[model samples]
Target: MKPEAHYNTGPNELYLDVRLLQNLSGTAKWGKVLAVLGFILSGFILVFGLFMQQMLQSPGRAERVADVGLSGFTIVVYAFVALVYFFPSLYLYNFASGMQQGVQERSRQKVGKAIGKLRVLFKFLVIMLLLFLVLFAISLVMLGTGLSDFSLQ
Candidate 1:
């Protein structure tokens, strides 16, 4: 008979190492910086979208109904993109804040909440990555079909 290895699984054992805490603190600072940058970028995108819409609707330009509709669609797409960027940043910011507070106060609940926010951010990223991959595959298929249709005699 083989002897079983003993393992220490006490509830009082430290789950987080000191090194990890240091790293997390650094990450929180960077996250704050990134979140601010994302907000700035979203603002710029919003301004550009509005500017584009206005340019398309300017009285000096002879705008067709289709052109106006297209501009509106473009603005909508821009808004969606801006929202996508904004949301993840918001989550990241929250995580950073929670982690900072948790560490400062040595509160387990705050740390858990911070981890939860991080999970949400990761989930959103994974979904976006999958969506982009699917879109890329579809584009490749479309391009291949389009190229096939343009063969010279």
Candidate 2:
């Protein structure tokens, strides 16, 4: 059964005005655009990574890559990076979709789900940021101690 008292006075309940709905709609549109773009870019990256090994089969590419201390593993890393890029874009898309539906239907549950997806996306970004920071610190320490040569080589 649907509640007929959508406009009832509840202190903890949120009231979405016209302005808020417009804003949400706009945000959702933008988010959808960016997510689609991200998906396309990630697809390109994965395709490139997969075909890189075949490219290396060509004349001098493998030798050049070897000279740079890179090997077949580098292709795997590219694909991994692409996969990493994909999840956040997916989260953003889900958030956008949920928000749009919630606004259209005036469904608080859908909006809440959208917010949850956004929160998860942020948490994932923070974790990735921290991991990169730690890696940067380690790299700096290695360089300071003149151990970069040993590590890289």
Candidate 3:
């Protein structure tokens, strides 16, 4: 049997450029800082939401129940907004950490994991943007119809 020819695969191995690594490292640090801030903001929003709910339930505030109810709705909205801000921050932080580790260790797997997290972050943002666009379009349509009705009266 003929011996198999040895093929050189070393040149095909992926290597991150020095400049790219430097850029990624800087970005990772910034992402970590932003993630920490996002967590703090989310915590505050949660606390404020709970406080609003508690105030609404207090006995002496019965006369302002309607206003309190509006506040309750506002709390829910804020909580959702906080969550929306939070999840992306978490993904961004993870990506940053992973990328930093990958660079330090020169591990392709770690870098791939970091890229995955970044992909998730981008996907979430895109979905949110699409949702907002749809809602804006619906609101515009509603406003136009209402205006038309008013003009006919």
Candidate 4:
């Protein structure tokens, strides 16, 4: 069969342009950065919680494991952080799929298209930032109160 026919026909005759693909790549880049940031922040929070729990439970001991309170905090922090990671990852996947569609539609791209893409990417990034800030604030409040099903101490 024909190569073009195989790659761009029947079940896969997706139509897209270079400008659109560039925009998608820009958005995907933002998504990747956000995903990485969320993962890193989550890791940091988990480690911090572990350390704090160790300190709280171990005045003289040296073993390091989270206490019940800190463990609860870690779980909550991780859950939200996981969510932070999930959205960007989902966006990235959608963006990449869309970009592939654009590629099949148009064989070439340009700088202007890339720049236009950057605009939406930045907007999405800002939204993610706002989300992070709000969640972080909530986490801080929870931490201040201490994570517990019931206060034993």
Number of clashes recorded per candidate: 0, 0, 0, 1
RMSD of 1: 5.5
Q: Least accurate stretch of 10 residues (summed lDDT) in model 2?
A: 6-15
Report how far off residue 8 is in candidate 3 (Å).
9.2
Candidate topping TM-score: 2
Question: Could you give candidate 4's per-residue lDDT for residues 40-149 as a string of tens digits?
Answer: 76667666656654565665433343433453565566566655655544444454444544454542343234334545556777998998799999998888778553
The per-residue C-alpha lDDT of model 3 at residue 2 equals 38
Clashing residue pairs for model 3: none
Tens-digit lDDT string for candidate 1 (30-124)? 98889889989998988888887777777765367465576678689889889988988898899989888777666677788899999999999
User: Cα lDDT of all candidates, in order?
Assistant: 0.81, 0.86, 0.81, 0.56
Return the TM-score for candidate 4, rounded to 2 decimals.
Answer: 0.41
Candidate order, TM-score descending: 2, 1, 3, 4
Model 4 clash pairs are 23-117
Q: Residue-wise lDDT of candidate 3 within 1-73, one digit each (tens)?
A: 3343342224323366689878888988898898888889888888888887677767877568766466468
TM-score of each: 0.80, 0.80, 0.77, 0.41
